[model samples]
Target: MKIEVSLLAGQQLKASFADHEIISDQSISAGGNAEHPEPFDYFLSSMPMCAAFYMRKFCQQRDIETTGLSFTQEVITLDESNPYKKKVSMKVTLPTDFPKKYEKAILAAANTCTVKKVIQATPEFEVELVK
Candidate 1:
């Protein structure tokens, strides 16, 4: 649940969490080597991925087949005055044969994603320089 991030060469950043490491970097045009996903990419991906996890869990508990389950996320920018994402759309595709009874439950499960709740709540942050 804890992550430590440090600057690497150029615009690369390394983040370590739960005994694993992940890298983030800008594109070559953005002064980075583009070796890994950029910070914003990770931010945008967090919601859908979290929801997907819950969706899978919901299917598993119901003994439902998940062979064709898919989730795609898209972001829309509101205006030039705001450079951040204004809206996020997540599309979930279930197998045609999937049970109709579980459809609403599945959607509810996806809404349980913690990251989505955090984003909606707009948590506050405290930043300070430490030595």
Candidate 2:
């Protein structure tokens, strides 16, 4: 999958992936960012969303009925020297009727979220500053 982002103007950006489009601006506290979600938020959001995606699929495959699902993700930076590096914790909430027998399996499915796997596996990328 490929995503493309283009700068629209000052503090404004646009991103496209497949059939979807996203617009973002700087934050009011940080500056003027339109009504769009910040990049950092997306990073944090990806984890829970990914986990939820896999969880839903896993449940469906197992004939489990998921009445509801939600998640909260928090990131803690252990070292200020490396601000980009941090650890994330996710709290997942599911419907009360979710089967107790499937708890372990569901948790395992959450662990397989694409974003979780990416963070844990630490894939490498090459960075180049272009003029």
Candidate number achieving the greatest TM-score relative to the actual structure: 1
Model 2: what TM-score? 0.83
What is the TM-score (0 to 1) of candidate 1? 0.94
Which pairs clash inside model 1?
Answer: none
For 6-108, candidate 2 gives per-residue lDDT tens digits of 9887677888999998887878887765477887777778888888888889889988777776667889997999997787878778788888888888889
lDDT of 1 by residue, 1-131 (tens): 78999999999999999879989999999999989999999988999999999999999998999999999998888787977638788999999999999999999999999999997898998999999
Q: What is residue 92's positional error in candidate 2, in angstroms?
A: 2.1
Model 2: colliding residue pairs:
25-33, 26-33
Best by lDDT: 1
